[model samples]
Target: MQAPERIMSCERPDSEEFCYFLAKDYFRFVLDGSESQPAANNVVETLRRSGSSLDRSGRELEHCINKLNLSSIEEVERVLPSLMREIYSDGIDNWGRIVTLYAFCGVLVSNLKKKGVPERELIEGVAQCLAQYTWTHKAAWIKENGGWEKGFVEHFQEKKNSHFYTKIAAFTGIVAAFSFVIYQH
Candidate 1:
């Protein structure tokens, strides 16, 4: 089957917000059941055609959903860590890709919860992994600027540094909030 055309634009490919929106739209499309094919099948086909590392992860995730019956919490527990590790280990240097993966995980976790899966452990594990990665990246930026102590002092003093980190935090918060809303509806 031919993959559906990408509906969202990615002009700001480096922006976390852009990637999060793209992931949200993609998940919404897949989960809404607006297409003739199964959502997992369509997602896999689309990702297989996109040829990006993020898409590759999506394809693998679709396969995992199909193969392991993700509706089951036990199956998710067995599969999620390795899937997360694969995405993390793929050397995806782009923040957009990382954000996309983070959003995808959020959507997946939310969906599983909606399906009545007890997912405290799964949510905590995924959140911890993503949070650690984000912290590591931010720490590197702080180190490059001077060091954590100096950076923290300067971050409050400098409007630019404060604004940058605030934007990052806001984007993360927005994605989390959006995912919760999506799951609720």
Candidate 2:
């Protein structure tokens, strides 16, 4: 199958509102992140079955998560590398580094979960790698790239140093939820 298209627009994933929306709507009860394809479909079906009983916010959130959920793991896996490339893109003055990094963090979390790995270990490892990469190596790239400041400024304005750390917390929640759903089956 053809690779899924990348999200070309640059947006930060640091918003608590966005994270909460993702947490409640997208990753809420993912019992089997590894069985992501079927599990995602099931979750979407569950949401669809719930239908208009949902409020406007609930419906919108459900729809967004449904979009993320319906995509196959094979498709997600195929696009992972390309997503990484965009994170490390050259010459484009891309300010979406942190946003891309956060998204990649989510994908990596999902990938590891789907691999049937331990939830804590998977999320912790990826979060550490991301922190190290951003502070050491990626920091240099940001200094050279003009677009970095915009992303950083916008990302931190909401909650100071919390965004980076908060992502890991959010990821852990999703992974834990995935594990819980798996154990229930």
Candidate 3:
């Protein structure tokens, strides 16, 4: 079967986008466990100090994910390698940076939603943005907390055609490949 759709597609702010955004945020923080409250707090403090004027509490979330070294949808495609290395370090074998970027996109969409923007449109925007980086090096990412299969299945249930689903599938594949490679050593 087709593994599933990747989340990069849902980076757009179209209809049904919120479903993906919420699912993305849910997976990163709740499932992936890379997002901590301290990171959220750092984001809030940074925005407040920088006077970014982003009013939603979700902005803190956005800031935190970005700080984790995830790229913003606005980032150019060429800069991803450096960005990924900065976040994942030598574990570049595991596409942790890319995963974090997807997670960050989810947060950005949610932030827009909290700021009174239409959830669907914001989510679609996120998906569209992700579609750009849809082909980042295809490396495996560390499982850190949980396995990708369980997380992807739980996060992308009936939403099979969505960007979130696609991302989960791709993420799972990447992580699985990495695990296989490590096992061979």
lDDT (Cα, tens digit) per residue for candidate 1, span 1-185: 22333333233323333233334444444344344443333323333223233433344433333444467556544554555444444343333333345545655665676777655555545445444444544335434555323443344345433444443543444344333433433
The residue pairs that clash in candidate 2, if any, are 31-181, 31-182, 34-114
Per-model C-alpha lDDT, please? 0.43, 0.37, 0.36
Candidate that scores best on lDDT: 1
Tell how far residue 52 is off in model 2, in angstroms. Answer: 23
Per-residue CA lDDT of model 3 for 123-148, tens digit only, reads 44555445333333321221332323
TM-score of 3: 0.32
Per-residue lDDT of model 2, residues 142-175, tens digit only:
5554323344444345444454454444333433
Q: Is candidate 1 or candidate 3 better by TM-score?
A: 1
Report the lDDT of model 1 for residue 183: 43
For model 2, give the 10-residue run with minimal summed lDDT: 1-10
Worst 10 residues of 3 by lDDT: 46-55
Residue 42 in candidate 3, Cα distance off native in Å: 32
Clash-forming residue pairs, model 1: none
Ranking by lDDT: 1, 2, 3
Error of 3 at 177 (Å): 26
